[model samples]
Structures are given as C-alpha cells and as structure tokens.
Target chain A: MQNLALETVAPVVESVPVPKITAKDVNVHYGEKHAIKDVSVDIPAKGVMSFIGPSGCGKSTFLRCINRMNDTIPICRVTGDLRIDGRDIYEPGLDPVLLRARVGMVFQKPNPFPKSIYENVAYGPRLHGLASNKVEMDELVEWALRRAGLFEEVKDRLKDSGTSLSGGQQQRLCIARAISVRPEVILMDEPCSALDPIATAKIEELIDELRANFTIVIVTHSMQQAARVSQRTAFFHLGKVIEEGVTDQIFMNPRHELTRNYITGRFG
Target chain B: MSVLYFSLLLVMAVLAFALARGRASSGARAAAFHSRPNYHGLLAASLVAIPMLVVFVIGAILTKMIAESQALTALDPALLTDPLRRGAALREIVEVANGRFRGNPSITLQAAGDTWAYVQRVARFSIYGLGLAAGIGGLMFALRSITPDLKARNRFEWLVTVLLMICAGIAVLTTIGIVFSVVFETVRFFQKVPPMDFLTGTQWSPQTAIRADQGGSSGAFGVVPLLTGTLLISGIAMLVAGPIGLFAAIYMAEYATPRFRSTAKPVLEILAGIPTVVLGFFAALTVAPLIRGAGEYFGLSVASESALAAGLVMGMMIIPFVSSLSDDVITAVPQSLRDGSLALGGTKSETIRRVILPAALPGIVSAFMLAISRAVGETMIVVMAAGLAANLTFNPLDAVTTFTVQIKTILVGDQEFDTAKTLAAFALGFVLFFFTLTLNVIALAIIRKYREQYD
Candidate 1:
C-alpha cells in the first residue's frame, strides 16, 4: 500500500534537459563526522532550484560544495563526482579560485565589503579583470547594480561606505557583487534569512528575475519561499536528500514519507 | 609585639566569621535570609579585618613617635638644638635600646638609652591593647548585627569595590608623583640652562667643573644632538620592524593553519621575553662588528659602535609587539568579510591586501606607533651598543647617543644635585616621557576612532 501511494504521488521529472550541474554520490565530511552522505541531484540550467530542510540538515553544506567554498575549511573534505557543464569541478587541475569566479555565492547574512558602494560592486569585476578601463569598470558596476535592482536607491552616493546601506540594500549590493563577475551560476545560502519580510520579498523577486539568465541554487528554511520562488524543490533530512521533484508536486503531494512529514510539519 | 597583635586579629576575624555564619544559617530556618550564609561570614570577616588594620597602622606610627619623644627628653636641651646632633643622639639611643650599640657611651647617653627602652616597651604594649580592643569591638558589633533581614552581600560587595578603587588609585597616584618629581627637576635644569640654548644649540658636552679651581670646561648643555640621535635610531628601528612584523602578522592571521598558529604565536612572543640586556650584548658583540665589516667592505666609515647596529637589534627585540598586536586586530576582522571577498573570487593575497588590510588599517597603524614608542623608550640596547658620542646626524653608520643613554651617563657616579650636568638627566627623562606619551595618545585615538568601523 505504501509503495502504491508513493508511486502515484511522486512527480516524474524524467525530462531534465541538459542539467547545468550534476552530482553523483557526493559525500562531505568534517574531520570524522559525515555532514553530507551520498547525496545525488541534478540542477537544470536557468531556473531557481531551492533546497528546503530543517537547520543543520547539510543543506547549506551541500550548497557551498558547488562553488568549492568548502575548500577554505581545513577539516572539511568532499569526495565523489561533482560537475558543472559536464566538467568535473573536483579534479586536481581545476583551480577552486577560477571555479568560484564561474560560480558566484551570496552568504546567509548580508556582507558588503568595508569600502565605497562603487568599490563593493566593482570588486568581483576588478578581480576577474573583466573591465578594461575606468569608464568600462564604472559602466560594469552600474550595470551590475541595475541588474540587482539597487542602482536607483544608491545612485546618488556611490562613494559612501557599503556598510552604510540598509540591511536590504546591503544584501542587494552583495548580489550585485556576485553578479558583477558574470558567473554562469549563482548559489545563495539562506540569503534572506537575516532580512525582514519586505526585504525578503524584494530579494525573492530579484531571485525570480535572475533565474531567467543564471542557474540559481537557493537554500531556504521557509517552505513557502521554496514553493513561491523555485521551479524545483529538493527536500533534505539528516544529511540526505529524501526526495526532489517539481515544486508544486513536492509541496502538494510528497512521495517519500520523510518528505511528506517534513513538508506537512509532522516532524522536521 | 605587633606580630602577636596581628595573630590575635586574625583569630578574632576567623571566630567572628564562624559565629556570624552559624547565626545566619540558624536564623534562616525561622525566617528567610536576604543573603547566603557565605555573605554573612564575609561581612563579619571584613568588619573585623578593616578596623583592626586601621588601628594597627595608626598604633604603629603613634608608638614610634611617642618612644622617640620620650627618649629625646633624657638628652640635654642644648644638645638637641642642633639638627645634626639630634639625629646622632637619636640613632645612638635607638642602637643602645636595641642592644646593638658598640661604642662607649657617656652618662647622659646611658640614661637616654634606658629611657628609650622603657618608653618603647610601654608604647608597644599600649598599641597591642588598642588593636585588640578594636578587633574585639568590631567582632561583637558584627555578631550583634547578624540577622536574616541584613543585606550582607550588598554591603560586603560595596566594601570590596571601595578596596579595589583604592588599589587602582594608588597606581595612578604613584604615576602622578613620579611626573611631579621629574617636572620639578626639569624646571631646575632649565633655570641653569636657558630653554633656547639647551633645545636649539647643536653641542652636548656635559662636563662642568666640580670645584671652583678644577680644570674643566663649563659644559655646553645643548640637547639637539641627543634629540637627533634618538630620532635617527628610532627611525631606523621602525623601518626594519614595521614591514617584517606586519608581514609575519598577516601570514599568521591569514594563511597559517590553526595548529601552526597556536604553537608559533607563543614562540614568537618569546622574543619579547628575552632579557633586553642579553639583546644589548648581542648587539654590541655580534651586530656591531658585522656592520663595521660590511661598511669596510663597502668603503664606508662605520663606527665600532654605530646607531645602525643598536637600531637593528632594538628592532628585533620589538618585533613581537608589532606582530602580536597586529595579529590580534587582523584576526578580529570579521570572518564574514573574508568569506565575502573569497566568494567574489578574489585571491588570498588580493583579499588580504585590499580588503583585510584596509579594514584593519587603523589597528595596524596603532600597532606600528606602539612599536615605535617602544623603540624610543628602549635604554639598555642603545646604552651598550651605541657610542657615547651625541652626534647630530641622520647617518646610521655613525655612533649616536639617545636620551636614555645620555641620562645613564650623566647619573652613573656621585655628583652634586645642584649642578646642571647632574640635573640634565631629569630633563632628558622628562622629554622622553613626553614623547612616548604623545605617541601612545595618538595611537589610542586612532584605535578608538576606527574601533567601531567594522561593527
């Protein structure tokens, strides 16, 4: 009876055409503790895919692995095949530094560089040597800010410290910073977790707009946000992905018992 | 005798605590105590200890005065008129009373000695009686006041706070006292040598005549040479230490693993723990000759004891100060900032140079200033390695003397305090103090201004 119910309720996502990122049996360990255990998922290109789970469920950890940001931790170790555009990112020849440029990240809290608003937006472009001259760099910075929907709010005071902005503006500035590098993918780790409702709504709207051009992966605790913004939703529990499918089906009719329990608030 | 009183006071205080705690705990069964039994015990102990300590101090002083006055009464009035004679007679009387006198004593001296012994015994007994009275009275008062309603903890805490304030005030008052003493001596030095001539004149030979007919030049009291020499050596020291220490801090803070940092930071700080005298010897014996050899190879004249040698060794000694302070501030920069930079695809070096360093700039600048101040105030290295010649030049190859070195030279042997040469040490000390104080003030101001920037 259980298998019949699961088979009927589960959404069939068999036609994921040319997924932008693919992971097979990916495992992450911090020293002796396994944080992510044999997780496998394919993230399709040019869409918002949200990972929804309870806290400490390895959702953020798995998110960080995409950009190889986990390389910074001394004890953290990752194994198994992880790829972007069918190229293995974990290969010894592929530099994590260059990989990060191709895959930009926004942190849980809004972190703008302790510099002028112009400098914060220009940092990634400058680092990647994207702009050739002062005029081009200014244009690039302005374009990034416009893309992140923060250009009009901060157009008058480009010279002010980036930290001087409001919480929502700072998050947008960080988004601009990430987008300035022109990455193929953007990974956001609970980016609106530290913002108020209005700020969260604005960021959610920006994320929706951004998915038209970039393969965006977001980790959020709010199932409402996952259902509202993402086309696909992956449910994680106890360091494992329990189920993944189209967002409406995942929320309305989860296949796995664990996924259904989590979505319906029976138990995290 | 005072030892006996001290023991008596200790016993009384302990007994008072035990009695008060027992009373408070027993009363707690009937009613509720506002404070714990331990607080009640502390209040009792403090009451006994404070009053008894006061009585002990005042009694000791009063007894000495009374014994000295009583001994003086046995001496001739005419003999006591002269201050010198009075001091000698008092010393003899004290020596005889203590049974340590060896010289032959006149009849009056013998009588005075006997009176001194008698008066000392009486006075000591009276002090013992007074201290015991204070201790017992305080114990009884505290015992009577032990009730469940008494707020013993608050009262005891207030007393503790007052004691802590007094201890802190003593440190401040001692510093003020030293500053005043230096100010007085510096004023006297200025009276003998005009401020303009001492400050601006470029000569520093401080050899003055000891006697009216003694053969010596009335010294040139100019301090310009010493001032320039100090600046030159300290400047050299900062140049050497500033970059090396900052780089070490950056490497430790940004790149080194946690295990490496934990072990290496202490070892680096041990550089500061090496006795400065040892560093001075190293400077004089090893570095000085090496510099001289190098200078000779380069066809340049380097003194056997050059400012460069001293400055380099001093710089080595102060590296820990700069590195340790800079490391703390750099490490204190929010980890989130580093993450933000790294996530933007900035390389480690780029992130450190442009993001971390710029954010930690004020702290780094303050650390450098503190290191410069340490170099300026350093005495032993300059005294042993640098020559005594007060050369007014910026050349590091030449031997130069600092303010501390000159002060040491001026005050080494017996000399009259009234002379300009002797008083010159105090003036140099005052100037050195003022210079370091200014540096510290500016450094602290910079730190305070930028402390809240990241937050």
Candidate 2:
C-alpha cells in the first residue's frame, strides 16, 4: 500500500508541460553509508516545491545534487540519471562551475563574501559577463537587489561591509547574489532555518515572487512552512520518499502510513 | 647558601599544604565547605613560600656584597689607586678564597682569603635563620586564619595573578635595562666622535696604534660604509628569498593534496631547525669559491668572499621561516570565500588569486616583515662568509660586512673598556634595534587595520 501511494504521487509534481528537473533511480552514497536510496522524482518548471523530513533524512543531500554542491564533499558520490531541461547535468561536457552558475544556491546560514555590499551582488554578473559595461553592471546589481527586496534598505550604504547587515538583510543579500547572474533555477537548503519568524515570512514571500522566472526547491523542517511556501510537497523518511503530491492534498489526506504519522505527529 | 635556604623553604611549604588540607576537611561535610580542599592547600603553600623567597633573594645580594668587601681589603693601598691593578688584585684574592689561587699569594692576601671565607659562612647561617623564621611565622598565621567559610579559593587565585604579573614584569624590566645600557655607551661614543661624522661621512677606518711611533692614526669613524654594506647584503637576501619562498608557500597551501601537505610541511620545517653555523661553513667553504670560479669563467672578476655568496646562503637559511609562516597565513583564509567565488563561475586559479589571496594579504605581508627581520639579525652566516671589509658599494660580486659582522669583530677579543672602538659597536646595535622595531610596528599596524573578521 505504501509503494502504491509513493508511485501515484511521484509524477504528480511534474504534470506541467515541461519539467525543470527529472531524476530516475538516483542514489547517493557517502563512503559506505547509503545516504539516499534508489528513488525517482520530477520537479516542475517555475514552481515552488518543498522537501520536508526529519533531521538527517537526506533531504538536504538530494537538494545539493541539483547544483552539484555535493562535489565539494570528497567522500560523497552520486549515481543514476539526473537531468535539467532535458539535458544531463553530469555529462562530460558540463563543467560544475558553469553548471553552478545556471543553478544558484542559498544556504541555511547566510554566507556573504567578505566584501562591500555592492561588490557582493556584482561579483556574479561580472564573472558571468552578464553586463557589458560598468554602468550596466551597476544597474544589474541594483535590479537584483530590488527583486530580492534589499536595495531600498541598502542602497545608501552600498560600500559598507556585507557582514555589517542584520541577519534578515544578509539572507536577502545572498538571494540577490544568486539572482544577479539570472539563473534558471534556485536551490535553497533550509534557507530560513537560521532566521527569525518575521525574516522567514519575508523570505517565503520572496520565494513566491521568484517562481515566475526561476524554479525554486526548498528543504524545510517546518511542516507549516512546507504548507505555506510550496504548491507541491514531498515527505521523506529513512532516505526514501514516502508520499508526494499537491501540498493541500498531502497534508489533508496523506495516503502512506509513514507520511500520515509524520504529519499527524505520531512518529517521524 | 641561597639554594639551600630555598630548598628548605620548599619542604616546609609542602608540609604546611598537607596539614592545611587535612585539617580543613577533618570535621565538616564536603558539601558544607565553602572552598575546596585544593584551594586551602594552595593558600597555605603560597603563604609560607612567597615571604621566604623574598628574604632569600635579599640575603643573597647582601652576602655577595660582604664577600666582595672582604676581597677588596687584600689590595695594597698603592695598587688600589690604579683601577686596573685593583681589579686584578681583587680577582686574585677571590681565587684564594675558592682554594684555586693562580700564583703565589702574600701573607696579607691569604689572611684576607680566610676572613672572606669566614664571612661567607656567617652570612649563610644568618640567611638560614631568617628563612626558617619566615616559613614558621607564615605557616602558623595561615593555619590559624583558616575557617569553614574562608574564601581560600579567591585568595589563591589573586596570589597566582600577582605571580603571573611578576613574571611579565621581569621580562619587560630586562628589556628596559638592555636599552639603557646601550644608550649610555652610544652617548659616550658620540661625545668622543661627532654624531655628524658617524651618520653622514663615508670613510670607516678605526686605527689603534701599536706603539707611539705608529702615530697619525686618528681613525675615521664614518658609519656610511657599514650602513650601505648592511643594506646591500640584506637587499640581495630579500631578492633571493621573497619570490621563491612565497611561491613555495602558495603551492603548499592552495594546490597540494592532503597527503602531500601532511608529509611536506614537517620536512620543510626541518630546514629551519638546522643550525645556522652549518650553513655558514657551507657558504664559506663551498658557495664562495664556486661563485668566484663561475665569475672568472665568464670574464667577470668576483671577490673570493663575495656578498652574493653570504646573501644566497642566508636567504636559503631563512626560506623555511618565510614559507612556513606564509603557508599558515594563506591556509587560514576561510574556505567559504573560495566556494563563493567558484559558485560564481570563476576558475580555480581565479578564485585563489582574486578571493583567497586578497583576503590573506595582510597576513602574508606580516610574514614578509618577519622574514626581513630574521634576515637582518642573522649573525653566523654573515660573520663567516662575508669579508670583514666595510665597503660602500651595491655590487653583489664585491665583499661586504654587515652591522652584525662589525659588532662581532669589535667585541670578540676584548682589550680594554672606555675606548672608542668598543663603544662604536653599541651605537651600531642601537641603529639595528631601531630599524627592526619600526618594521615590527608597521607590520602590526597593517595586521590590525586590514584584519578581516570572517566569523
């Protein structure tokens, strides 16, 4: 019965005309540990999707695989077919550096470059050659910050250190940094986990606005956050997806026993 | 006598500690006591030990003065008028007291030696009495004062704080003492020879006559030649060390694999551990002659003891200091910065050059400063390989003498005091000290101002 529930809901999130990310039997291993078992899922293009699970359940691992952030870990290994926009991301011709530029990431803790606020946002545009001139680069930076809802607060002191900002402002700055290069997708690994409630709500609103242009995938610990920010929701348990479907249906009528147990506070 | 007195005091302090700890915990429940048993023990030990040490030091100084006076009495009144003869006579009397007389001693001298020995014994007895009194008095007072609610822990902590302060004060005071002595000697030297000549003039021949007929040797004391020589040698050393050491450090920190780093770091540090004298001999015997031969082959005349040889060896000797310190500073840069750069589509080389190096710049600058300081103060290699000729030329093929070499030459075989030749060494030392001090201050200020807080 659990297998049936998982199969039925796996393809439901990809019902759009063209999917952004497609995975088939993806398995991740960290040394001898089978961190992510053989599993499959599809993320729709230009939508907000959330992966909710207990701590250390491989939700963050699967999220890191989208942008190849897992390459930074020497012991981690990922196998099986994974594609974005109908092209294999792990193909021989694709450099992780170039792939990462197309798919940006925001971490749980805001990690800004130790530079001026203006430079932090301008770094991506300059490196990717998104802007041709200095004036265009400055404009692109301003536009990205405005889209992330940070320009108004930081416009006057653009030369100040990025670390001098408040935690909420810094997270927004990281968001602006990701958007500066005009990426096709954004991978957020518990982006609001270190933030206060107000800051978390602000980021949730920003995620909704970002869905029009870029696909967004979020790994969250909060059930309410998963329900609030995502249209499609997946529940993971023991390194495997238990059930995934429309957010309202997953919460209101969970089919699998483990998913219902986790949502109803019976067991994780 | 002072050592014996201190050892006896140490034994008494230990006994007092045991007694205090045993008594403090005798009747009360362990939980009821305000202070732990260890604090009570420490308080008792320190109370007995500190006063005893103070009295022992004072007694030691007094005993030294008394013995010196006794030895002075042996000098004849006629000889005492002459400072040099008086000094020799006192030395002889001290040898008699120690039972190692160098020559035949007169009756007056042997009698004075007996008197000195007797006085030393009396001084020892008096010191022992005073030490015993301090230990007993302090122990009795400490034991009587201990109660159930006494704040023994706080008192012990304060005592430890004072002890640490005294240790720090000793180091600072010793530095001040050295500076004052050098300044006094430099002043005396300036009074004999004008400061303008020493600072600005070019010649540097200090001639001391062998006899009256070997006269007309007023001895020019111009410091310009020595200063230029020192600078030329140091510049050559820096030219050899700066780029090579920095590149080695960059490779170690940025590109090397973990296994390579683990194996190579210690091997490089071993270079620093080798004594500088071994390098001196190698420079003198091997490198100098090789350069001279190589220069002759090219139709270029190189001195047998060229500045290039010493500078090359000195640079090699200090390479470990530069590489190891720069490696640490570069490796200390946060990995997150690299990640940020790479995620922005920058290549590995670009990330390292733009983000990591910029962030680590201040630390690397300080490493260079420290390396330069090491180069300036180096003694053995310069002393052995570089010629003693004080030449005011920038040519690396010619031999040159550094400030350290000059100082060592003047002070090695001492003939007399209050002479211009010996005092000139102290003046040179003061200039070296000032140069290194200013460099350190500038380095520290750069480190402070550009410090990137990454937490």
Candidate 3:
C-alpha cells in the first residue's frame, strides 16, 4: 500500500484544488469497536467523489462525520480533526442542526417523508427559510424536482404522497428534498442501491449534472458505478483508505493489491 | 352419585364405538381420511353427552317443582296465607319429610309426613321416566345416523362455532336488554312527572308520606341541577387531567429513557388499581377539608362536600387512563416520521410538536374521550366528596350532586317501588348513558378519520 501511494501515477498534472473538507487523523469508536482508525483525507470542491468499499468498512461512517449525522447516535464518538470548508463542525457552539442544513444528505433507502410530493421537496426549504413566500417556495420545490429529473413524472401529482411514487421516483424525490435546501454539498450514501438498473442509470446521469453546480460525494459499492459517475475514487478496506486516485486509472491501471483485487472482482 | 358416573361411562362407550367404526371403515389406506379418528370420538362423545345433560337438567327442575307443589297442596291450608308464608311452610314440610327435622310424638304430623313421602315418590318416578325416554330416544337417533363417511366432527365443530357466536351475541343482547329496561322505567317515571319539568325544573326534593293520613309533598322531578352538577364536576376533572395526562404521555413516549419509562409507566398505572371507594373517603375526609381551608384563605366559602374536591380526585383516578392510552398511541406513530423531520434539521421539540403530535392527535382525542366516559360512570368519589344537594349552579366550589349520587341517594334506603323517588334513578342513568355514548361515537369517528389519513 505504501509503494502504491508513492508511485501515484500521473497525479492529474493539474493544480490540486484547496480541500473543502479535511480530516486530520480522524478516529471513531462505537463503544469497544474501533470503527475508523487514524485516517486522514482531503476532499476538494465542485466535483463528484466516490467512496468504494466492502460492507462495514467505515465508508458510511466517514460520510456521516462530514455532516455530524453521527450526533444522532449516542454511543458513537469521533476524535480528531474533521472540518468542512475549513470550519470545525464539532467546535464549541457549533450546532449540528445548522450544520446539517448547510451539509445535506440522502440516505441509502430513499426514505421520503410521508407527505405530499411538493411538501417532501419543500420541507428543507421551509425549515431552512430558503424561500420567503409560498410562491417562492413553490418555485424552489419545482426547481429541485426539475434538477433531480423527477418533475416530468411527478408534476401532475404534487399533492399526492411521496410514498405513492414508484421506488425509483421515491428515491428521486429524496434527492429533490436534499437539493431543495441549496446546501453547499450533498452526501449520498448508496443513493442508487435500492433502485433498478434504469433508475440507477438515471441517478448516475443526475449525479454528473449535479457536479456542475454543487460538490457531490457518494458512497457506492459498485466499482463500475464509481467509474461512471465519479471524477475521483477512494477505495477503503478494513476501515482504512488503501488508495485514492482518478477513477479511470483506479479501475484500469495498477494500484494497491487490495484495490486491484476489489476492482477486478478477485475479492471484496 | 351413580347417575353422573353412569353417564360418563355411557359417553366412553359411545367414544369407543365411534373410534372403532372410524378405524374399521378407513380400510388399509388409513391416511386417505380428511380428519383423524379422535375427531370422530369427540363428535360421538358430544352427541351422547349434550342430549343426556339437557334431559337431566330439565327433568331435575321439573320434578323439583312438581314435588314442591304437591307438598304445598298436602299442607294445612290455614298456615299458607301468602306466597312468602307458603314458600316458608313448603320448605319446612320438605325438611320434615326428608327426616331433617327433629320433632316427634304426633300422629297427625306422622300422617302429613306420609303424604310428603308419597309426593317425593311420585316426583322421582316422573324424573326417571323422563330421563330414560329422552336418553333412549337420543341414543337411537344418533346411532341410526352414524355412518362410515359421516363427517360428524366437522359438523359438530361448526355447531360449536355457532354456539360461541351465539354466546357473543347474547352478551350484546344483554347490554341492549339492560339499556331498554332502564329506558322503559325512565319512560314510566317521565309519565308521572312531565318531561319538561324533569329536564328544566330546578328543585329535586322528592317528598314521601310521613304518616298514613299525610299526603306526600309535591315532589320536584327536575334533573337540571343534577346535570349541572355533573357538568361542573366533569369540567374540573378534565381541567386537571387533560393537560397533565397529555404532557406525561408526551414525556414518556418521546423523552423518557427505557429505565425511567419501565418504572414510571407501571407506577402511574397503579393509580387505576386503587379502589374508587378508598379515593372517595380520601377526598371526603382529607381533600375537602384542605380545599375548604384554601377557600377560607381566599375569603370564599367552599362547601365541605364541594364539586371541586370530587372532580379533582376523580381526575387523579383517571390520569392513568389518559396517559397510558395516549402513550401507546403516541409511541405507535412511526419512528420514520421523527427521523425524517430530524434529518430535515428540525429541532427535537419542533418535530414532536408539529409532526408527531398532529399525527397522534386523533388517538389522543380518543384517549380523552375514554377518560370522560370513565369520569361520567364514576360513582363513589362523587357520592362521598360531592354533597346530596343537587344545586343547579355551575360553580365548582358549590355543593353539588351528580346523577350517580342522586341515584344512590334515592335507592340507598327502603322505599316503595311505585314512587317517583326510586324510579328517577333509572331516568338519570339513561341520560348518562346517552351522554357517554355520544362522546364515544364522536371520539371513534375522529380516530377513524386519523387512521384513514395514515393508511
């Protein structure tokens, strides 16, 4: 693993952008289990970054750390530096509620609120006071839905429950909800795992379009998906980042033994 | 003693016949049958026991009645003047004839004893004849119908199912019967006293004749005072219970840890187990005096048995009724909704207040309605804490008598059945039933609407 990091292939030959998020020797412990070891990583702005790992490898934990979603769990403890856009989210006087609004997340299971489709999309905007009036809120909801490519299918039934939509449409409705708040960044945890292949393709296309406006970070188990949607990919193993590089190179070229094995379907 | 054992033996014989028949007719391919052989045994046992038991009970009752009547007829007619005296004399004659009496040295008594003996013999003969005829008739009919292909077990089970349905139907029918009885008696009461006077008249004193020549005073049948008293007490009770119970429920469901929840819930429920009579005394002796002192401090006259005292204690009794049910309904609201609200950056209190409470509103309303019904039906607390005076005013501090209290007062001591005093209790009960039923129906409708919202 040390030799692979040193080799570093072309390194993109471009000026590396300033890190929007930096984790300095971050470690998380859930009771007796050391979920994430001393891991350091930096994520840059305005592009899709993918975290690829086997199950229970701390990929989801690391994503939750960005938004302080782990605060909801009583036993989970994170020690060391984790900053978003150079701001310490865990600093004294920092409110997780405020931080969550600034750093939005979409869950793996596509849990849309048991509310009307319009309400589902407008919920974040309403909570964050993103829109001042009903008309503005309506426009914001439509914009978010349009961005998620769900407007055409759900436009006629904005008043219907979000759950009444198909599995794929529900997932998109969740995405629309996340985007409605106009957060600086969106964290998606296996956003397409519960969707069919067609929906998966649609979400991948939406992710590519989303990268033009907002910084997007997604956790996915599908290597091909990571290659298709992400500009950069990080491979995790045993709660440690084994390799991080351009997605194309990571999939096709030589890398760490574990990363190579995982990419080639030799082993998880 | 032998008869019961003999019946058991007959049942066993029938079971053996059915089991053997089933086994023999099932042929070499035993597994081909739809049901097991024991089912046939049970069916045959039921067929034998049911008819025999019915005959035994009927014959026993009939023979007992006939024997008693014959003994009464043989008794000296001068000793049995009325139905009450006749019953007592007949009982004594039966005891004497059975050799349970210790009297001796009288020829006429001995002759009467012989006549009693003859009556017993005739009754016994009648019982034996009826029992034997019914038993034989049933046995023959059942045996003739028995066949190898007969699915007696299925038919018998179906009959049992219908019997259970009838039993349940009887419970509903019994409730209806009781309601109608109250309604009919109340109608009779209203016929004597005009409905308008009963409903709108203020005074409730029912006068009775003090002497044979003195006519009873004109009794006031107004129910307004009782209705007002009931409303005042119920209002105070709801005031005490509604907010406290609902808040406690919210805390238990949303905020309490598992350890605190497990301990607190049962302790709260223990309030419901305390007998209402005990609470009544506590209210009467302790709370009423304390309230009077408090009222004195405020320079107000609070009656010793005030509506406020009774209502507060009754409210305490019904707290568990509201809290436990509300807790269950609030907890039943999906955790996903909470998570969704929190994920959207809503504060915990905000999420609970806006989302969870609204979703659980109907259930909470139903819980409150149930509590109200319980309050209306409660008798003991009001009887002890609230006074016998049916004051028509709505003031909680004033002495008041509820419908239940009035009913208890009217029926407490011996009174003539024909008087309006005794019958008014039924009328009051009917009004109470109507009020509680309306509350329950409205609450149920609200709950149904909310259920449909979620479903």
Clashing pairs in 3: none
**Tens digits of per-residue lDDT for model 2, A1-268:** 2233443344333344567998787899999999987657778889988999888889999988888888878899999889999899888889998998988888888878777899899988877789999899899999999999999999999998898898989999999999999999998989899999999999999999999999999999999999998988878876777677789999998876778878988765
Q: What i-RMS does each candidate reach, in Å?
A: 1.2, 2.0, 2.1
lDDT of 2 by residue, B258-296 (tens): 899999999989989889899999999999999999999
TM-score of each: 0.92, 0.92, 0.80
Q: List residue ranges in candidate 3 displaced over 4 A.
A: A1-19, A39-44, A49-58, A108-119, A148-170, A189-209, A219-268, B1-167, B207-217
* DockQ for each model: 0.64, 0.50, 0.34
- For candidate 2, the TM-score of chain A alone versus the native chain A is 0.94
Best by lDDT: 1
How does model 1 score by TM-score?
0.92
Worst 10 residues of 1 chain B by lDDT: B446-455
DockQ winner between candidates 1 and 2:
1
Candidate 2: Cα lDDT at B43: 98
Tell me the tens digit of each residue's lDDT in model 3 across B1-455: 33754665485557545754565356665555454666655665566566666666776677667666666666678776788787776666666777886667255445555677786677666655665565556555555665656676787698689779989999999999999999999999988888888888998887755566876566788888888888889889999999999999999998998899999999999999999999999999999999999999999999899999999999999999999999998899877677666766778887788678977888899999999999988899999999898788887889998888888888898887778878888888889999999999999889886665454
CA lDDT scores, all candidates in order: 0.89, 0.85, 0.81
**C-alpha lDDT (0 to 100) for residue B444 of candidate 2:** 93
Better of 1 and 3 by TM-score: 1
Question: Residue A115 of candidate 2: its Cα lDDT?
Answer: 79
Candidate 1, A44-157: lDDT as tens digits: 999999999888899999999999989999899999999999999999999888989999999999989888899999988888899999999999999999999999999999
lDDT computed for candidate 2? 0.85
